[model samples]
Each structure stands twice: as structure tokens, then as C-alpha cells.
Target: MAGTETHYTLPRPTFDEAPKLLIVVAPYYKDIADDLIAGAKAEIEAAGATWEIVEVPGALEVPTAIRIADRTADFDGYVALGCVIRGETTHYETVCNDSSRALSTLGLAGLCIGNGILTVENRDQAVVRAAVDQQNKGGGAAAAALHLIALGRKWTGGEKQVGFRPVGA
Candidate 1:
């Protein structure tokens, strides 16, 4: 079973300056979301990073929230948390695909985002994944964001240079 499988987790990243992350959560599933938040917060703190959170209505809105924050806020990275359990209708696929795609698009555009939104066949799967002591997908997501932030800082040397510059000037 997946619960019994072992996976290698990357060591928590280190930084010269602590990163400030914005956690955007979709609290459609209150209990599940809370557990996810707990795990993510623990991971963020463990890495000597700081975080602030904002809630959106559902999974689909999580990416939009992150995009807005990236444009108008000063966060170094973002953690996206939510739960989407399959239901009787086709809404599950739409929510799952669109949200995942948007988050990926933003990531490709150089936004450091950890996507923790769970798309499960049932509530039981979500519960297991969200549990802080179990799968802890939330923590995994935070670690991903932190690693990306570390990489970004390393490559850019913490500088943002816009516009064209002469090569070997």
C-alpha cells in the first residue's frame, strides 16, 4: 500500500536570509485543510522560514490567489493547500486539471510555488494524505517551495535584473 511505501525526502534547505512565504489555502474541506496547514506550517518553521496565510473558497481559486500575491505581494515563495474529493459529477476533473495547470503555468513563469492541493478518489485518501503524521503531502509541498527558493537565490544571487544588457560588458 502507498502508506507503507518509503520515499526519499530532500533535506530541508538552508538560506543566508530566511524566506517569507505566502500560504494560500482553499478551505473547502475544513478538517482536511487544517491538517494540511498544520503540516505545512511545521515544515516552513522547521526551515527557519516565515509564513502568512490567506484562504480562498475552493481549489480552483488557490492558483489565482497565488498569482495575485506574486504580482502585488512581496513573498519569496508560495504554498498552495486544499482538498478536492471526487463526487457524483464531473466537477472533480475540471477542478483538478485547471488548478493543477494554472499552478504549473505560474511555476514555469518563475514563481516558486508548492502545490499541495489534493485530488483524491475519496475523502479517506485525502484524510490520509493531509494528516501531519501520515503522508504529510503538505509538508512535502512546503519543502518543494523552499528548495525552489533556494535554487532561485543561488542562480540569481538574490538580484532581479530587468531589461536588456550588453553581453560581456
Candidate 2:
């Protein structure tokens, strides 16, 4: 049972400047979404970071929102929160695969993103995972974004100069 499983969690990363993050959530399941938001908010605050929240219509839109924010917003990182409970239709698979892929693509493009979307067998699983006191997938996602932000700051040797310059000084 997942409930009985134990896993090691990394200590929260510290930041010289408090990171600003945007939390994009799809509230298809209102209660679940609320729980997820709560967990994510708590985690962000605990790390001494600040965050803002935005709601999209569904899971498929979560990545798009993040991408737009990355381009036009001054956020240091992003946290994606949503719940996709498997249904009788194949739409579940589509949402799960497409959303995950899009988020991965954004991450590969250098956007610091934390994917907290819950793809589960049913609402029961989502409830358990989203609960702030339980798995807290939301918090886990926030933690992921924080870690990536730390790595980016650590390795960023200032902006690389593009194009050519004059020969020698």
C-alpha cells in the first residue's frame, strides 16, 4: 500500500533571496484542488519563499499557463497543481500523457517547474495525496521547484554573451 510506504525526502533548500513562484492549478475537482493549494502554499511559505496562484480550467491547460507566466512574469519558479481521476473514457490517458509531456518540455527549456498534478485511479487516491497532512503531493511539487531554482541560481554564471565582439582589447 502506498500509505505504508516510506521514502526519503530531501531537506528544504535554502535561498539567498526568497524565490517568487507561481502556482498554476486546475480546479476540476474543487475540494481536491483546494487541498493541493493548501499544501503547496504551506510548503512555499515554510521555505521562506513567496508564491502567487492562478486557476486554469483543467489539467491540459496547466502547462500552458506556466509557460505563459514564464515568459511574461518575474517568477523564479512554478508549481503545477491538478487532479485527474481516471474515468471510463480514454480522455484520462490523453490528459495524463499530454500534460506530463508539456511540463517536461517546459522544464527542458530551462523553466523551473514543479509538477504536482495527480493522475490517480480515483478520487480517494487524490484526496489522500492532496491532503496537507498526508502525501502532500502539492508540497512535494513546491519542494521540487525550489530545488530546481536553487540549482539554477548556483550554476548561473551570469548571462552568456551572445554574438561576436571586437578582436582583442
Candidate 3:
């Protein structure tokens, strides 16, 4: 069974300079959000990184807040945390897709973002995922962001200018 399978986790990364990260959370489910935040914060601190937290209304706002921070804040990375339990309506799909898309777009645009938003069938699944003793999705997300930040730093000196060059003057 998938549940009995062992998952391979990447080795935790170390950094010469402490990375600063912003954690944006949608606390629609307060308990779950709190658990996620705890896990994420622990992971960040374990990596010798600093982080700040901001609360949004719901899952949809998590990415939006991250984008805003990316534009105005000096954080090296961002962690997006939230839970979206499937309901009777189609709102679940909309929230999941849009939030995921926005985060992906921002990541592609050069922002280091860890997306921990949970889209599960019920609260039980969310609880397990958020628990630090369990899946610890929050920690997984933070680790992802840290890895991306490391990659970004690794390539910083090799950045090439890309744009149209006025017809080779």
C-alpha cells in the first residue's frame, strides 16, 4: 500500500548565509494552519534561516500575499501554507488550481516559493499532513524553498542578460 511505502527525503541543506523567508498562511482551518506553521517554522530554523509570518483570509489569498511580499519585501524566499477541504461545491477545484498556478508562475518568475497548500478530501487528511510527526507537509514545503534559494544563489554569478538588443546596432 502507498501508506506503507517508505519515502525518500532529500538531505537537509546547509547555507553559509542565513536566508530570510516570509511565511504566508491562510488560517481558514485554525488548528491545521497552526500545525503547518509550526512545522514550517521548525524546519526553517533548523536550516539556520529566519522567517516572518503573515495571515491571509483563505487559500486564494496565500499566493496573492506571497506575490505582494515578493514585490515589496526583502525576504530570500516564501512559504505558502493553507488547507482546502473539499466541499459540496466546485470552489475546491478553483481554489486548488488557481493557487497552485499562481505560485508556480511566481516561482518561474524567479521567486523562491514553497507551496504547502493542502487540498484534501476532509479534515482528517489535512490533520495528518500538517502534523509534524506525520507527513509534515509544511516542513517539506520549507525545505523545497530552501533548496530553491540555494540554487538561486549558486547561479547568481552566472546570470545572463536576456532581452531584445536593438537590432544589433
TM-score of each: 0.93, 0.93, 0.95
lDDT of 3 by residue, 18-113 (tens): 999999999999999999999999999999999999999999988889988978979999999999999999999999999999999999999999
Best by TM-score: 3
User: What is the total number of backbone clashes in candidate 3?
Assistant: 0
Better of 2 and 3 by lDDT: 2
For candidate 1, the 10 contiguous residues with the lowest summed lDDT are: 153-162
lDDT per model vs. reference: 0.95, 0.95, 0.92
Query: What is the number of backbone collisions in each predicted candidate, taken in the order shown?
Result: 0, 0, 0
Give the lDDT of residue 146 in candidate 3: 95
In model 1, the Cα lDDT at residue 136 comes to 96
Task: Show model 1 residue runs off by greater than 4 Å.
Answer: 157-169
Q: Which candidate, 1 or 3, would have the higher lDDT against the true structure?
A: 1
Ordered by lDDT, highest first, the candidates read: 2, 1, 3
Question: Global lDDT for candidate 2?
Answer: 0.95
